[model samples]
Structures are given as C-alpha cells and as structure tokens.
Target: MSSNLAGNQATERKRRIEKYFQPTPKDSLKQIAVALLAGGGIAVLLGLILLSSQSFLAVLLFIGGGYALVQGAIRKARYKAEYEKAEPKPSDREMDRTLALDLQQIEDRAMHRLGITADHLETGAASWDPVAALLADKMVERPKKRPLVLYGPKLSDFGIGEDGVWRFKLYEVLVICPTVHHLAIYHCSLDFLSGGLSMEDTEEYQYNHVVAVSTRTTPAPADLSLERLNTRDPEDDEVRFAKVLRRRLEVSVSNGQSIGVTVGITDEQDSSKQAVLQSSGIDEVIGSVRRVLRDHSRP
Candidate 1:
C-alpha cells in the first residue's frame, strides 16, 4: 500500500512539473499512437466504402491501413510499458540539483580567475553584496591593501532570467580610492550567460596608463544583459515598450584594458518614473566615480 501511494505521489509530482520539462517518451509515444490510429481507422473506412469500382485503390488503402495500425499498436505498447514502469523523478526547478551545484562551482572558479581572493573580500569593511561590492584588498598595481579599492563583480541587472537561462554582463569594477596619488584598476569584464560565466582575461593597471573615460546615457532596447542575445528587430509596440534608460561609464587603459559598467532602469510603461529611478541609481554610482576624480574622495 505504501509503495503504491509513493508511486502515485511521484506520478502526481511529475505531472505538476511537466511544464518545465519536455514531454516524456511515454507521452510522445502515446500522442503518436493517437494520431496514427486515427489515420489508420480513416483509411480502413475509405477502403470499405470504395471496395467496388475502386478495388485496386481499396486494396492499397487496406495495406496502408494495416501498416499504420501496426505502427500505432507498436507505439501504444511502448507507451503502456513505459507508464507501467515508472515516471522520471521530477524537480521543482528546471535545472537538476547537481547541475545547479556545478554551476555555482563554476561561478566561484570564475571569480578566482579574476584574481579576487575570497579571503581578501571577506576581510573588507563593507558587507559583500553578491551583486556589487566595494572591496579593500592588495592589488597588483599597489602591492598593498590600504590605498586600493575594487568596486565589484557586479551584474548589469539583478534577478534571474525568466526561462532559467538568463545572462548578466559583469561590469568592470572601478578602482578609485582616496589619497592615492594614482588609481590602480583591476578589470574582469564579461558576460555570465545561461548558467555559465563567459569572462575575459582579468587585467590590473595604473591610472597614468588610462587613455580615456567616456560616459553616456541612452534609450535602451530590450535588456541585452538579462535576455538572450537577439538581433534588434523592427520596433513593434511591445518592443518599443521594452525600451528603458541606460548609462555606460567606461574607462580605457593604454594596454587595451577596457573597463566599464552599464546600468539601467526597470522597464515599465511610465517614462517619467523610469527616468527618475534610473537617474537616481546612475547618479549614486556615477557620483562615487566623480568624487574620486574631483578631489580623491574615499569611496
């Protein structure tokens, strides 16, 4: 009785989670059987109706019906066997637990690759926000801790992708601390797409090596960072509605270290609301950079 109850529960759970999964072999086979059986029955019916003058056609239809019926029977039997056997264990999430765990390990490894030591970050004054961090650490340029700051392994957008496979572009962490005669920047820029971190080579450099700093705010299309990579299409109403405001603050080093961050506001129909919110966020972050530039303020 207990075994039967467990099997029924498992089946129920599988059915509930079906939306996240592809149709099973059993379900696929069953559907195929339904279609083929209907086709076969129709053929047999037409064959019987045409048996007099359409005798040859009737015979061919009979043969075709037999073939379809045979295939349908085979599929039905397979589906029955599968149903009787068992359903696959289901998860509430689309990705398996093991895959999720492995993906986390990949994130950790990727962070390490960028030369941001866990110990160094842990010892910093500010509590580490997984999305953004103003960190205190010894950098390659300074080779000491006190005078340096690392801004983040921050995401362009916060929140998961709707389809369980979202992408977030990791912004270039800024390095402008107070009282330091020259800034020492560490950049690990790239995209984290579809549960995998697709990152560039981590770079470290001094302020004097910087070639330019450019900043811009513009109307953005559907979020390229959070959504899957898609070519821009002709703007329909929905596409135009997805447009929000975005700001990019970029600094380029002499040796090809392009450090930048792109931040944007939530997409909503209220244009004024979006602008106000976006400007607030952009100003808060950009103000820190501006302060560092203006009078070497501690951030």
Candidate 2:
C-alpha cells in the first residue's frame, strides 16, 4: 500500500513538471530510456561484481549494454537528420543578387538594410605606410596588450547635443596608402560610438574595409607642418585646424560632418611617400565638401 501511494505521488509530480517543460515525445522517450538503461547497467555491473556473477550472467549484461549503445546511436543520428531537414536553404536568386553588387554598392545596401542615417556616419583617414600596417597588426593581434586611452579633453570637444546627450560614434574608416585608383583600408569602431546608432537586424558593426590601388595620386606638401587658426568656438580647435588645412591644401569638409582630403607627395623626391587620399567614394560620403575642397585646391 505504501509503495503504491509513493508511485502515485511520483507520477503526479512528473505530470505537473511536464506541463511547464513539455518536450517532444521522441526526445523525451529517448532521454528517459537512455538514462534508465545507463543507470541500470551501472548498478547491475556493480552488483554482479560483488556477487561474482556466472559467465551466462556476464554475457547477458554485455549483450544488453551493446543493444543500448546501438539504440542511442540510432536515435542521435535521426535527431541530427531531422534538424538538418528543418533548416531552410537560401534561394539561388538571392545568392546571385548578392554576388552581383560591387563593393561600394554592397556597402550602401548594407547601410540601408541596417537603417543607418547619414548623420550616423563618421569618416576619417589614417596614413597606411607598410611600417604602419605592421605596427597596426601588432595592435590588432593583441588588442588587450595595448589599451586605447579614452582620456583627454580632445574627446570632450567631439560634442554634446542640445538635449544634454552626447553624440557617439556610428561609423569609422581607416584609410591605408590611399591613392586615386586604389587604397588599403581598415575599418573599426568602439561600443561607445555605436551604442546610439540604429542598424539593421543582420548588420552588426559598421562596414570596415582594406583596399589596395595601383594608380593616381594626391599631392602633399614637402614639409609636414602644423599651424593653429582662431575660430569662433574654441572647442573646435581640431576642426578649425582641419579647416585651415583644407583652406591651404583644398581638402573638403562635408555636411559639417565629414572631412575629405586629397593627399600625396608634393614633388619628385616623395614618390615612395606616395598619395594617401584620392577616393571618389570618400567624396560621395563627404557630399558637397568635395566641391569645396577640390575648388580651393585647383590651381
């Protein structure tokens, strides 16, 4: 009577648990059978060893274990096959469409898909000397070793909005050995910069690129020099400096947002130094800033 009552309670408890955590019939059966067979075999082996089991008993135990193993294998194979069958395959048309687009177009489409706004994009260029690439690879390979500093008042001037919120980063470009026909590129971002930006479901980080080019150039002056210019807003010393450079060299600023530069060796001695900025897409990104920079720079 006590055993019967205990069994009834266990059954009731199992039913209640199953109501909240329902599993498929096949899976539940397989799990229960595997657990029971495994536990029972282990218990029987221990018991038989203690009892000094007859040869016939040992043979029966071995046969049962083999059967259990085969059963488990069959169930696992079926489960894997069912899972693969359930997954959807992409259509050929979809794959073809993706393969058809050029890199720039692909970038644009990805941006559109992610719902990134024009305001969300930030553009900047870094010189890509082979020496620099090697140095950069060192940094990239061991990011934690070289902790980036987020310090300094310079970052503060990046701006705070009228609503008392700060604008974060949305996009970034690292141009390596930029030239008229080709460039080497590295794209990156920090979470702080991208946190507020809206992006597409499938899109994660802003697109980054590395490119190489073979032709054309933008001229840079013989001496790399810096000069400060006064501005209405002291906070924009960096922007003002950029503006001064644009005025002197004819680089452009776009949408009050982007900076478009045309950089190269000024003369014959600087051939290997090469052009560092001459990207059409860079102009597209900077918008009318291109005209401002180009017009000013034109001889």
Candidate 3:
C-alpha cells in the first residue's frame, strides 16, 4: 500500500510538471495540424501507388481516412515528446541586437546634444577562437597608413550571450572614423559597467594601450582617455551595450617574454566605439575618439 501511494504521488508530481511546461492547446493544435497535413499527404501518395488496381474513388477515400488517423496519432505522440524534451532558450543574438539598437539611439542622442559626428553602426558576436587571432593576423596585412588596434579578446571573462551561453559569448560594436588615432575598442568590464546605475573604475583600451578612462569620475590620463562615452541624457537616445573582458598571456617558447591584451568594456558607449574601431582599422579609430573628446571639451 505504501509503495502504491508513493508511486501515485510520483505520478501526480509528474502530471503537475507536465501541466506547467506543456504548450497551450492552441499551440498543440497548430503543431498537430501541420504534422497531419504533411504526413497525410505522403500517406495518400503511398496508398495510391500500392492500391493502383483497386477502385480509384474507394482508394482515395480509404487513404484519406487512414492517413488522417495515423497522422493525427503520430503528431499527438510527437507533440507530447516535444513537450517532455527540454527546450532551448532564446539566443544571445537577441541580446546583441537589443544592445545594438539601444546603443545606436544613445549615440544619436549624444551626437545631437554634443554636436558631434555620428558614424556607422555594427554589432556581432565575438568568440575566442583561433579565428580571432586571424583578425589580429589580418591587421598586419593592411596598408602602412592603416595601423592595427588590438581591442582585446571578448567573452571569456564571464559575460552572458543572447542564448544564455554565458561561457563563450561577446557583444561588439565598431565605429570607423577617418584617422588611425581614432581607433579604440571598449569592452564591458564585467565588474564596473555592471552593478548599480553608476559606472566606475572605467577603463580605456586603444591600439596596444590600456588606461583607466575614469576612476569614480576622476580624470586620469589625458591622451587615449575619454571625456564622455555617454550622451549625458537619456532623452537623447537609448543606451544599450555588452562587453567581455579577458586576459591573454602570450609566452614565447624560445624566449621567456610575455604580453597580453586584456579585454573589457567600461560603458554602453563602447558598443558605439566598436563600430569606429572596425571601419578605419586602428589609426582611424584613435583619431575619431580624440576628435570626439576635443569637440566635447570645446567651450
């Protein structure tokens, strides 16, 4: 009796869980209808071929009825299986797109308020593969005038992607300006840009350089530093961004020398910054950032 009671309880719990996760009747019906149409059509074709000698009208009706029954049953079983199986969450691409849209609005607002130049916008996932190094490798192939700005590796230091793939996802934006000095890549510092409404311990990264953009609103280095990455008003635009920070230590097998590009973002502005970084390579990126600062500081 106790065993039977325990089994009953287990079954009840399972039924409750099923009720929680199962798709609505409307969704189930849609899936079933689609499946039945597809399967029934195939069954009809097969039946006609197999019973070619039988009365055409009889075969037609028989096949139609048989197909409906079999297909409906199969679809119901398939739908149940689908409901039981774990479903995949939405992709990180959704988050990246949202972040991109928000950042663009922010840029527009900032540009309007500050009277600055607004550049092109681009967003995509940044993954740490040998492929990323190829981006670095390709940078060497550019013309002498076009320098490379190693923005740093994205998405290994703990950031979430659109699909909830927090382990290996990166959100990037690139802005292309005219000069080499304008190239700068800002990453989301997992710690700083995150947290409360205020941004702190801000960091700046340029071609082969890293500096704190601001420390609790305190000005740090003038060169390669940003006066303002934000538009200074929410009314100006929507702010959306994401970043991944990672440290890579490259050690030589021949010589014991090492250097690394630590990836991170300081603000939503980095998403806009990335667009510039991608367009003109490194030199142009640096130039753009400097120009924005110069214009922002002008009386």
Candidate 4:
C-alpha cells in the first residue's frame, strides 16, 4: 500500500510538471488531423493496390511501411538517449556551489587586475541602473524588459597627465544581460582639453558612439618585448614581432544598433596603448562577452 501511494505521488508530480509544457488544444488538434490524414492516405493506397490483384505491390507496400516504422522508432530512441546523456546529474546544492566558486574567482581576478577592493566591486544586477541612465542621457535605445546584470569596478583616482593640461580618470565596466553579456566598457574622463579646444568644443563629441564588440581568440604565447628584440634591424624586429602583434579578438559589431557604438576597448591607432590593453585582461573580458552572445543567439 505504501509503495502504491509513493508511485501515485510520483505520477501526480510528473503530471503537474508536464501540464505547464503541454500543447494547446488547437495545436494538438492540428497535429492529430495531420497524422490521421497521412496514416489514412497510406493505408487506403496500400489497400487499393492489394485489392487490384497486385500481390507484389502489396508486399512492397508492407515492406516500405515496416522499414519506415523501424527507422522512426530508432530515431526516437536515439533522441531519448542523447537527451538523457546531456541532462545534468548533479544535485542542486552541488551545482550552486560550483557556480558560486566560479563567480567568486572571476570577481577576485577582476578586482586584482582593476586595482579595486571588494567594497568597490558591485554585483552585476545592481550596476545596471547607472548604465541605463548613461544610455538614456545619450539618447540611445534602452535595453529590453529582460534583466540586465553588470559587474563594474569603481572609478579610478583622478590624476593629472604629463601635459599638465588634462586630468583624467579611467575604469572598466562589465555588462551581462539577456541579449548582451560579458560586454566590457572602458571609460575615461578628461578634466580639460589640451589642444586649444575648450571643454565645450569636445562636449559635442559622442563618447557612446565609440562602443564596439569583438569575439576573442586564444593565440600561442610569444615574447615581443622591444628591449629584448634587436632595435637596429627593423626587418628582423618586424618578422619576430609579427606573431606577438596578432590580434587576440576579431571585431563583430562596429557601431552596432544594439549597443549603439563600436565596442573596441583599445585604440588601434596607438600601438603602445593597444599592447598595454591586451595584457591587462581585456581579452578575457571580451571572451566572456562573446561566449554569452553565442549562447543567447542560439534558438
């Protein structure tokens, strides 16, 4: 009696779960009608051929139907096996612990690279408000109703540049949302313009338009230190440095409609700055964003 009661409870639970995913009445009716029409047509055709004294044709029809049914059953079994293999077997607590550890490691690495403490680091979900405001101020399209999560380090300390005319602060933000993920935004603010251009003159320049996106690639490590390479022989240096200078990521969207800017974190025009950016965990961040994009883009 106890065993029967347990089985009944298990069956009831399954039914409740399946109820949410069950097809609508309209869809079920349409599928049934199609199946009936196809099966009935095949049966009628085979029956008519059998009645016409075509014993050989009837045999062929039976053979064909049997082959088709066997193939269908095989395919169904294969699909079920594959699905079972892919399903996670771990307990919920185990999965949660693994995920938590991974996130903690990522956060720690990011904080170390950005020179920020734990207090300065905000959870991805909490950081979206500032990003939304920035988008609104720039008249950019706001993200959809879907959840937006962003992991951002606090702004860097203000410092005056060598030119003495400009003081700036720099920081990086990581955005993860339903449609967009692992998006890294490098931000900079200059206290004043150095080239006779007033602060007002640069105000018209849209910084948001500078956003860009790229897919990351892992290249074999090579030493490209200029000091170690022969500076006198330009050709030799170029040949040796070529492999090291290869881009770690390829641009996907430049001035894209979704992000409203080219997402390039480093300026290609400045080779020195580009090299520095590459070494400073920019590739890792971009790689994360690319992964998220790929996962979400799938049907």
Candidate 5:
C-alpha cells in the first residue's frame, strides 16, 4: 500500500546517500590524469609558439606553461600521497562502536549538568541532506568533508503560562560532530496562538580556535563583530536558520584544534525558562564537545 511505497522510497533515498559518501578511487585517479594532461597540452602549445617566434613574448608563454605543468605535477603527487595515507573506511562494527562511545560520552556530560539522566533520549545518525542543503545555500564553497552528525538525546519540557495567553515549550537539540573537532549548537522554538503563527527568532555563537585543547566559558574566539550581523530579515525559516548557524571554527593546522560551539535561542512566552534551558544546554554541549576533542588530541 501507500505506507509500503513510502518506506521503499525512503530506503532508496538512504541507499543513494550512503553510496555518495563511499570513496571513489577510480574517479580520483581520473582527475589526476586530466590535470596532468591539461598541463602537458599547455606546454606543447607554448613549445609550438616558441618554435615559430623566439621573442620575449614566446619566453613568457613558455614560462607560464612550465609553471602550469609544475603545479599539475605537484597536485598529482599530493593526491597520491593522500591516497597512500588514507585509512580504509570503517566497518559496520567499528562504526557502531564509535557511535556508542560518542553517545555515552555525551550522555555522561548531560547527566552531570542536568542532574537527571535522560532515560528517553533517542540517538541516531543525523541525515546529511539537511546539512548539505543548508551549506549549499549559506556557503560559497562546500567543506572538503561532509561533517559526521550524531544527534544526542534531547531535553524538552512544556508548561502553560500563568496568564494562559500562551503555552511554552522548551527543547534543546544537542548535535555533535564526532569526526570533527568543533560543534555548532542551535536552539529554536516556535510561538503560536490558536494554530496561528506569532514570532520566531534565532541566535548563534562560535567557539575556540586554538591548536591546544582547553576549556573556557567565554564568547567564541572567532571574529563575530556587530558589522558582520545581517541587517535584513529573511522570508524562509530554513534560510534564516541556516544563516544563524553559518559560522565556522578557526582551526589550527599545527597541534590539532579546540572545540567550536554555537548557541541559538528563540523565546515566545517566558524569558526565564528560555534563558535557563539555553544556558544549561549550551554548557552541556560545550563540555561534551571539549571532552571529545581532548580525547582525540591525546596520543
């Protein structure tokens, strides 16, 4: 029936996504060949020009082509070196182990901060489509590697305000990037009245850019000034949401990197509840991310 068809479609979509993430050695080799060939072609054209006319212009052309060929060779060598150093993709068992460890670490941190264990916390691999889609709209260029997103347990509570004018719902989404040494946390909420929309807002924060692993509760070390803030309002919620989460971590190339954290908040009825949840959620995620980064940095 319709349910089965929908299930089949979902399965096919996931299969395609997984296939896309698989490494393609053949395609990489082909790209290397193409770059080298293009460089060689430029060199051959310059040689022909020099044979016809041995002038200053011909020498300049020769030098340009030589530079291109050298660059191509360098790139090819880099590609080969990277391929050699690349580790094989983890097996299903290994992935499961990694996921479990990541979840357990986050859960431990959450329990310590919230003072209550999240028994109903759900865990799963976050879909890449949404992340990719957001990046496509927000970034001029995509990241070299698709970030591995693992959704940690969510903390949510609902209550009716004393005035009875609106009901308040507070929830925190803890999304961790286990593969990468940074985090971006978004906290969004909706305020509506009798099935009608009222208002929605989002805020973002970026964190640590040091090569050393350290814990600090300050504004993210990135260059987020008043001038960088957007002046116009966006029509689409997704567009606005993506904009709020578009900041990147300043990573150090030498001694690894520190955890990057971001926080977004949207409140409708009670500011106190929103602030408390937001602060606790941000603290929990930052601690969790720092723990993961420290473990990765250790030899």
Candidate 6:
C-alpha cells in the first residue's frame, strides 16, 4: 500500500514538472488567430465601403478591426516560432555514439596503464563501497590495491541556446592507484564533441603532498578557468527561467590546479534526463577519493 502511494506521488510530481514547460496548445492558438484575422479583414472591408455615410460606425469598425488584426498577427507569429522545431538530425545519435566510444577508449587506456589484466576482474573481492561496486560492475580491470577513481565531465559550454538547458559533456577519467611510496593518478579526457582523444596525463603525488579533495557545481566560466568559483546552485526560478545553463563540477587537488566534471540538472531536461544528470555518481566518486585520503594520505 505504501509503495503504491509512493508510485502515485512520483507520477504526480513528474506530471507537474512536464506541465511547467508546456505552453498554450499550438493548434488552439493557431485556430483562434486565424479566426480573428478573417473577421478583422471583413470588418475593415465593410468599414471602407460604409465610410461615405455611416462614418461613426465605420470608425468604430476600423478601430476594433485594426486591434483584432494586430493581436491575431502577434499571436500567430508566436505560435509559429514556438511550435516550429527544426527537423531532427543524425548528429544527435552520432554524438551519443561518439561520446560512448571515446569514454570506452579512455577506460581501456586506464586499465592498461594500471597493469590490470585484460583476462577478467572479479568484483566479488573488490571494495564494498558503492563506487567500487560500480567500477567492479563494469567487469573492467581496476587495481586491487587501494584503488580509487575520480571521473566526471570536463567543461562544456556552447554559445547557442539550441543545446536547450543542458550542454553536452566531454568526460575526464582519473584512476588513482596507491603504491608503497606514492599515489599514481592516471587521467585522460575524452572529447567526442569535436573528435578524438586527449593526451593521457599521469602524475605521482607523494602521500604528504596530496592535500584536499572536493566536488562542487559552479557557473561555467567563459574560458573554463579555476578562478571565481564561488556561486550558488540554481534554484526554482533560476533554473526554470534560464534559456541555457552550462554547469561543471570543480574538483580541487593538492596541486594548485583543479579539474572540472560536467554534471547537473537543468531546467528544460525531463525527469529521465535529470536522473541521468544527477550528481550522485560524482559524489560517490568523490567519496572514493576521500576514503583513499583517509586511509593512505601522509599521516
């Protein structure tokens, strides 16, 4: 009984969300506009014919008809612009596939660099943390020794509102493996938006050198820099009213530099897309980083 109630409540919430984006019915608006235009045309013609004798009535007709015509034209124009979406293109599906392939390549590269065998990895013996379980579920190779990873979208910002509320994401994967003396972090970026893989970057941070780890959402900078990172998360009106929003997660490291992962909920995205954009995955990855710092960072 409780489960059923929860399901219904969820359904209602989604319905409300979808409703917020919807405008007046396109067909209804178009029909009313056409009617007004036709009526206004007839009224103007009658007024012109009666101007010689019925001047007062003709003047009234002219005023009313002109008002109706203007109103109708305005409404009609709005409908045309708001309803006429451009034809769907192959680029959407192609982009999705391209991103997937790029991410897969980076994951493979990380596994190879970390010395995880290609034969297979058993999740049964992997870390029980949610992030580890998720990595294990990939059936991909991950170092069994204090393995951790921080991965998310890189900065993606486009000038066009055609992306709607959500901009596309280019992913960066950071695979961290701890050694007796230091932590070897293997990282790479996959940018399918334009094309091709970014060069792999591997750096070793001594236990004591490693300092802070965090995840935060901030306004995407025009230049994608680390400066001026202070900003509040978008709320009800802020999200709903904005035409486009480019968001990224800033991950701070011991080094002066920080990395960004693209992830967030945007106004125009539906519930399913919103779920996919949830920051939970990013948070879990951060959680893994913290665990590593707690257990292995220079004491």
Clashes by residue pair, model 1: none
- Model 5 RMSD in Å is 21.4
Badly placed stretches (over 4 Å) of model 1 are: 1-37, 41-57, 63-182, 189-199, 203-214, 217-247, 252-257, 261-284, 295-299
Error of 3 at 121 (Å): 15
lDDT of prediction 1 = 0.44
Task: Compute the lDDT for candidate 3.
Answer: 0.34
Model 5 segments beyond 4 Å from truth? 1-33, 44-57, 77-88, 91-93, 101-299
262: Cα error in model 5, Å: 14
Better of 4 and 6 by lDDT: 6
TM-score of candidate 3 to 2 decimals: 0.23
Output the worst ten-in-a-row residue range by lDDT, candidate 4. 195-204
lDDT of 6 at 67: 85
Candidate 4, lDDT over the whole model: 0.33
Candidate 6 lDDT over residue span 116-200, tens digit each:
5433332223332324333333333334443445445454421111223232335566655555555566777754333345767
Tens digits of lDDT, candidate 4, 215-257: 3423324443322332112233222223322333332333443
Assess every candidate by TM-score.
Answer: 0.39, 0.19, 0.23, 0.23, 0.25, 0.43
Whole-model lDDT values for every prediction: 0.44, 0.30, 0.34, 0.33, 0.34, 0.50
- Superposed model 2: Cα runs more than 4 Å off: 1-26, 29-33, 36-52, 87-299
- Candidate 4 TM-score, C-alpha based: 0.23
The lowest-lDDT stretch of 10 consecutive residues in candidate 6 is: 226-235
Better of 1 and 3 by lDDT: 1
Report the error of model 3 at residue 190, Å.
11
Q: On a 0 to 1 TM-score scale, where does candidate 5 land against the true structure?
A: 0.25
lDDT of candidate 2 over 136-176, digit per residue (tens) = 32212111111111100111112222222222112222222
In model 4, which runs have C-alpha deviations exceeding 4 angstroms? 1-52, 87-97, 101-218, 221-299
